[model samples]
Target chain A: MTSPLVTVTDLKVHFPIKKGILAKTVGHVYAVDGISFDIMPGETIGIVGESGCGKTTAGMAMVQLTPVTSGAVLWKGRDMAEMTRSELRALRREMQLIFQDPYSSLNPRMTVRQILSDPMDVHGLFTGHQRKERIDFLLDTVGLSPGQADLYPHEFSGGQRQRIGIARALALDPCLIIGDEPVSALDVSIQAQIINLLKRLKRDFNLSLIIISHDLAVVEYICDRIIVMYLGKIVEAADYASLYKNPRHPYTRTLMSAIPVPDPARRTRRIILKGDVPSPISPPDGCRFHTRCPDRMEICHKQEPAMRRFGNRHTAACHLYTDEQAEPVENKPKAKEKIS
Target chain B: MDQKTQASILSIQNLKTHFFSRKGVARAVDGVSFDLIPGQVLGIVGESGCGKSVTAQSVMGLVPNPPGKVVGGKIFFHHRDLLTLTVQELRKIRGAGIAMIFQEPMTSLNPVYTIGNQISEMFRLHKKLGKKQALAAAIDMLERVQIPSPHKRVHEYPHQLSGGMRQRAMIAMAMSCNPEILIADEPTTALDVTVQAQILDLMHRLKEEFSTAIQLITHDLGVIAEMADQVVVMYAGQVVEQARTVELFQHTLHPYTRGLLASIPVLGHRTLGKDEDLVEIKGMIPSLYDLPAGCRFSNRCPKVMDMCKNHLPDLIDMGGGHQVRCWLHTREMIS
Candidate 1:
């Protein structure tokens, strides 16, 4: 695919669980365990899962905000993990992150002007009069007036503050932007506005994005391709159209069914997962989703399924499609019987 | 679903909940009206600052005094005007007759108290039940909400339980007394999609078992479609549209309602192509502190008219219990 913009290979991030006065690492929470994906230039790749599925951690780990325990993250064919301190700082300008909470992300004490200018100053982008012009340009670019530069984050509403966050992310003209549930905290109406704005910014700047969110609908609207994660593992990955049309993994199907249909008259029965998500610190043996997967077989409980090609661009990790000799249950019979 | 059997458990007429702010009187809920039938689920959908939450709080008489006031209209619960009731009289009905489950379970729940204590306290205060009896009832309620190991879970603090479990516990506590009406404000907002489904299913079952009326306040169109029998779409502290859930989804007359429904990206083959622009309402929701004259949605409405900017559209019925307040709809009717 003509060399992808960002490639993540077998990335693992384990957070240490400390115990007692000595603070010895007794265990680890395997947040993102050996997950791999690639983001093409100017393509928006969505990473979606339920809360605590390590989607946010993966996004943070890519930006080096969180420490990666193992594996490689290559930015334009260069391994980010092996980069020197000075090199990483320069690379930070090319790859930026937009946090979830706009309220908490911004400095309450600093005015809008100071917040926008500080990033440029740190990077040594411009000086004096040029900085003022650049800040004004950024404010205008994000659809905010010049006068709003003097106002603090508290003075702005949730939507406006989010606009400032977006403006900050665009300060360095970053090639790849990782938005971690950027619009989840805003109102539905405001969320629409921000989503629309993000689309515009992406097109205008010719940027590649890795947007992480739990809301499937939000992902469906913006992302070109999507990767579905479950308990620190990639359950399914496909282009937007293929994944939504024909989800191969049972967990993916269940997740798709769970999204509430907006039309009341066209109400489809929801596929309720049997149990709560297992703790990431101690995930289940074999497939992590086997505990909640409706189409789980005996082999699924014992053998870990590898990601197998479903179609040209789609892949899924499930025993149902794997080559391990097992009689395939016909679709009609399974549809009749409630799996849960 | 017979009309005669469907008595309004809670009836609100011309309810105006205003907040006395430093700048001016913020009309949070301006002349809003609705009726909640017994054992029926009513969904109130609106963006933030649209006064859906305020309307729910006003019905419970939980609006903070001095700053906030129920300025006009009667809130009748079983034909009793709640506005006229004294504090003691209202307190008796708060937990026993009508209970409220807030959006954030962690904040709403008492951090110091165990789940068992919080649930049982409602019974002890209103029902005047003994500690032993109240504890038993609390456990039963917790089990009904599908909390695993109710015996063990009841003893755990709110912080100890997961987000989904905490929400379920909140629902259990609300339905502990088998109240006539349960007002849930964005109950599943903090929960994941799978957990959200479970919670909604539990709520649906609870309504059937207890024969309780539910006033669900949320911005999610999906939840409203699944849970609500009747839906009320609010804008800038006003009721823009009210209709049966099916009818509202099928034939949305109001521009705001249409915009909201269109904005939501549906699963399956329903989305209008990848390149199609989402029907986002152009402008932001008008600030409650300084709302414009006439229709608040007029600024964002695509089919806006000069008349819409000057005169507020009345909620007119278009047959079959479907009502909408929009200048474009009224104009089309007139022409």
Candidate 2:
């Protein structure tokens, strides 16, 4: 296998919580804490988590939109963390992000043509006729007619607006695209269209994509590999087949069960996570999922489990799969029973 | 089946809800019709701008005044034409007979007012109860919706509650008067999967308890399959297909409905491999402002014919309460 186009190591984004008249930094919200992953060239890596699990923050940190507290964001052998101002500006052309809400992401006042051409103008990529030609090409590439370039965002439907967002992201022919819940906001029928478009564009452009979404089904459709996050940690990371077929982590299993099965007759026992997600400001001490984990043990309550590798590509941060507690499924309960 | 079992609690016939926009007349709900039977859940599934929502708003008489106009159709509620009712008469039936829970609970709820105050206001206005009596009723309603510590929660404002709690509060408010019918327009769309499951389960339990007919309008097929007793697939402001939930899933006749079912990527299903490709229905939903003369879906339909372009297809009954509006299906039946 070739080297990954982008490699993120120990990426942490913390927001300071200030208070009082002096506005002292009292604490910090550990949004994305020490998450590490890689995006292979021309491959899609999906990041799935519940709301406020810091998936969006992780994506933002990758693109330098959010300040990273500690980590090395190595882009093609070069660390983005060490990139200078001008270098970072140049890197922006190769790393583009498509926001979730097309309505808010795109400038409502600007026409589609103006919105698509803004990136080129900022980078000084093309001039005059060349720019006009590129804008029309992008519009056509995204399944929109050349005539639609003049229309504003509001005039288009949600799907069309999203296409414009995609076109804008591809304006500079970026090597990597970070789609932050891109299709979650669109209608299901329209979501299929956008997903297909993204898949086609990924192949056509040979782009490495990091898709951040809460929808497991959407992720299952598009991503080659997935990293499931809980609270502020990656609980499980595996290829799409293994993650769905045999989810190791309790949270991943719960998330898989939560996806609504379209066929009513095919009844799968749903593993309902008991409580609401804990506050990110002050996450639980041990396992972040222990609060709602069905098979939580006393050891799980006191000790934070480290991420353990299983086989070649699968990795999970759970006590159940750890080598120290290598026991059968039936005997696993005995360990918890003894711990209690 | 008994005659009364087939009776529709709410029946909308030939409904045409139009919005007079500055650009042109937007046919948001152009000639939509459906029946909601008692103790049944009718799922209205459609993409955005397909007029499923407009049809719901038309039923509730909640269409915005300036531009929206119900030009045609009779909305019969308990055999009484809702469109013909006076403002005072409709006001009396609004919450007591038919209640609606919108998508965004925060927007629907008053920010300044406490949850208790808002809930009690429904009781006071409709039931003509005293302040103290209404407050008790409000607390009971809150407790019934499974809100933890109803007394404490009732005092909190809408902003104080979480998204799931807010939706529960909204549901509590809607069911306070023991309404005959509940209209949930994408109630769980904005919520997370777990919250959405809980909401769907709550609705299921509430239906069994109250025996209230529900009209669920959403774009999610998964939600529809889970909750709906009957399903109505809409496209371009018309009911393209209608069938029992299981029947619709098993034997989808209409091309649009078939395409929709195929498009959804189900869990445990085969993934789209390198060789495998997704079957996307091409072309956008035509602008409601200027829809084509014939079948609206003819433009995007893979099995479209010359006849489909020339004339609109009538929703023909194909037995077992399955109705579909497509020339291909009609032709197959005729042949």
Candidate 3:
């Protein structure tokens, strides 16, 4: 089997909180506190969480857009942190990030052709005539007409602007595309068009994608693997099938139940977690999710749960499970005290 | 479900709001009509530029009128035509009769004022309460919206509060007056999923407890599913489909409504193994100032007929309180 395209091991991105005049570092906000995952070639991995959960920071760190506080991001068997300036520049071509807000992400002053051509110019991919031809091809690949290349970003609609963003990400033909809430800023109908475009691009380009979004529904639509994050930590990680069907961790289950399904008659019994996600600067001890977890145990308050493997390629950092091969058929553990 | 029109807490008929811009007359809200039944949630779901929020603004008399005007339509509340009311008369009914909460709490709440000071203003203006009593009422309102530590939070400025807390504070101010009808326009759109759930839950509890009617306008169908009793699907300044929540979900007559529903990827949808690419409504929303000759959604309709291109479809009633505005459904109405 081929090795994974990207591997992120124990990645932690902590931002310092500075106080008044002195600008002294008082404490650090644990944005991506020790999260590990892998993206196989041509596989789409979804990192799902709420706002301020650090999914965006994690994505930025992987692409070197944000300075990583600590931990390792292996890019094609080379450590991203240790790479030289030239090596880092080359690594940029292998990983591209599609930002959330299409309106602000693209420079208003630039034309669609300029937006698509800048990356190629930066990387020295092609010259004058060849670059223009490539720009036309890129715009066409993203379902926009080549004639519209002369128009500025303000002339296009939100969906068209997003297509331009996608074309920019694909300018270098990167193997991995990390989209941070790619379609969150668009309307439902426009969101559909963009999602379909991303899916088609993935298949055609054979690109591995890390979709960081608060929306699980959209994530599940195109992902092969899923990770549920809470308070800057992964509560559950599994293959798409197991994660959706089983959802071993209480946090994952809460998140699944919380999603507002389109059906009216079939509204699921919502597990509305009490209170907001605690401040990430000083996350709750033990399990990060225990504060909102309904089935939290006494042990959950004092000890952080290890990753318990229940299914093939499925693991959850929950305190409920014991045996490695146990099916976890019953969610409630009768043997141990379950603090409801 | 055919109730008396006289019983509706708020009734809107053929409301048309136009904006006079450099380009031309932008028909933001074109002949839109809906009613907020007593203690029920009336949802207006639509894409951007569909006039959902504009419809809400027209009801609250909040439309900025140098370039905007409610040129037509009658909004009848308490047997009075709100359109005919003077600015002074409208202000009398604004907070006490109908209160509104916006999507962005930071912009809505005054930055310089304390949370209690802002909320207390509602009590002072509507109830004519003294400063001390109004301050106490503000804290009570904060508690009602589930904001923990109301005592301390009431004194803090809007910036000191988190996003979720600030939203709850906005709700507290809206609820302070105890209005007959609450018009919430995209109230939970800016919030996170968990916070959104909490806010929606608060609205539901408040509705049940106070029996206040709600005109809930949103782009999210899921929120509409969970909250709305009557659903009105809007497209480019007109109601495309209106029905009881269950009927709208079950039958979904309009092509635009069907396209909107199909576009959203429902969670756990593929667990039963019906995997396929998302069904997209091709093309963008037409510019309101220069819309198509007929149906706004004509360019994107999958079952577009030649007749749909030049003729506007009527909002035809399909009985059982379900209404659809589409050429495809016009035949069924004729039958």
Candidate 4:
């Protein structure tokens, strides 16, 4: 098999909670606790979670945007943490970030051409005559006309501005693009346009993509592999079909069912989790999701479950199944309970 | 002959709300009509600039004046016209007869006051409870909405609570007086899906317990399909289609609705083929100040005809309470 484009091992990001005038660090909020995953070349991997789950933080840490407290993020066999300032800047060109909120992400004062060229200028890639041509080409690739390059971000709609955002990410011809809730700020129809654009660009440029979103369906559409997060841990990781078709972890199963189906005919019984996600600063013991998990056993509250692998790459961290000893977990069925 | 439907709790007829700015008039809610049956959920779905929120504001008489005004039409709450009510009279019915829950709870709730202090005011105003009694009832209200440790949470301000908790507090205040109607505009849009599920479940339970009619407005069809008994599809400040929830999904008529349904990637459904592109509605929503003389959606409509370009199709009723405004559905279509 071809070597993975990026590999993140045992990553942990902790933010200290400060109190009082002295600004003493009282306790650390376990933002990303410990998570590990990898992105293959030309593959689209999605990190799915709710707010405070550290999905965004995990993505940022991989690209060296957020400070990684401890862990190794190896980019093409080189550890990113060991890189110098100039070397880190060079690494940024290979991995660019696309942000959410098209309204706030783009600078109001900058024109489309300026936004696209700023990255190129910083990187010192193209010069003079060729730089102007590259800007025009980037805008055209994103489906905007060359004439609209002079217009400021305020003149464009949400969808068009997102396209401009994508063009800026593509300015350096990066090998990877990490989008954190990229299309969540746009309308449904506009979201579709952007999703399709990203798919096309990925295929054309052979780029590895990491999309971090709270939206499961949007991620399900574009990503071939998915990692489900709860609090600050990866509860499950599987190929697209296996995760949705046969989810192993209870949290993953509940999350899959929680989303409201668009078609009225397919209204399934939604298993609403009991309480709010516990604060990351003081997350629950053992399994972070044990406090709210419906299928919590006695062991779940005392000891964290190991990631047990099923067929192929489908793995889930749950005590329900043991390695090869237990029968297929789907055989024993329980009566469906609907909460009114 | 302004006869009210006996079962309808809220009735809006030919409602027209406009914004008079320096540029020109923006017909935000032009010629919209809908009725909310008692205890039923009526969902209004559309993109931004489609005026779903403005329509809700018109019913509550909360539209800011000076620039925004109810230019025309009547808002009847059971037999009284809300548009004609004075500020004092409207305030009397505001939280008691009809209540509203905004999208952003943090912004809507006052920062300085404690949650208990804010909710107790509703009890004192509407139920005429004593100060101590009102505070007790506020805690009870918090319990009803399923907020954990209601007693301690009551003393906390808005910022102290989490996003999901703040939203529950908002819901509690709205339901404290047991209003006949609850208008929630994009209630769970800002929330995560898991929290969204929790809020939706709470709303369902409260609705069943109080039997309160809900006017739910959201852009997500998933939420609309799951909760709304009746669905009204809006485009460019006009209702393009209205039908019962199941009927609308099974037999989607309007091109805009079809485009919207097809565009969103649904969960638990078959994924699209690798080569296929998502069915996107072309072009942007028209600016309210300059809408088309014809069907407002005609400019981007995939099945537009010559007649659809010049003459607007009326919202024609096609029996069984299904109404559609498109040349394909209307007999008034001149081919």
lDDT by residue (B1-335, candidate 2, tens digit) is 22532498888889999999898999888788788999999999999899988888887788998799999988989778999999899988899999999999999999999999999999999999999999999999988888879999989999989898999999999999999999999999988887787788889889999999999999888888888989999998889999999999999899999888888877656442422345787877888887888899989889888988879999999999999999888888989
TM-score of each: 0.94, 0.94, 0.97, 0.96
Worst ten-residue run, lDDT, model 2 chain B? B268-277
Evaluate model 2 with DockQ and give the value: 0.53
Q: What iRMS does model 2 reach?
A: 1.6
Candidate closer to the true structure by DockQ (higher is better), 2 or 3: 3
Report the Cα lDDT for residue A318, model 2.
85
lDDT of 1 by residue, B1-335 (tens): 33422378888889999999898999999999889988899999998889999998998888998799999998888779999999999988998899999888999999999999999998898789999999999999899999888999999999998888899899988998889999999999988999988888899889999999999999999999999999999999999999999999999899999989877766653244653455676768777887878788888888888988988999988888899998777777889
Cα error of candidate 2 at position A222, Å: 1.1
Model 3 over residues B34-83: C-alpha lDDT tens digits? 88889999999999999999998998888998799999998989879899
Candidate 4: the clashing residue pairs are none
Best by TM-score: 3
By descending TM-score, how would the candidates be arranged? 3, 4, 1, 2
**Model 3 stretches with alpha carbons more than 4 Å out:** A323-340, B1-3
2 or 4, greater by TM-score: 4
Model 4 regions more than 4 Å off: A324-340, B1-4, B270-276, B331-335
Q: lDDT tens string, model 4, A213-329?
A: 988888888888999998889999998878888888888888889899998998878999887889999998777888887876666777888878887888888877865743355
Model 1, first chain, TM-score of 0.94
| Stretches > 4 Å off in candidate 2 | A109-111, A127-133, A147-155, A324-330, A334-340, B1-6, B271-275
A106 Cα displacement, candidate 1 (Å): 2.1
Superposition error at A24 for model 4 (Å): 2.0
Candidate 1 error regions (>4 Å): A127-133, A324-340, B1-6, B269-275
Q: Candidate 3, chain A: TM-score?
A: 0.96
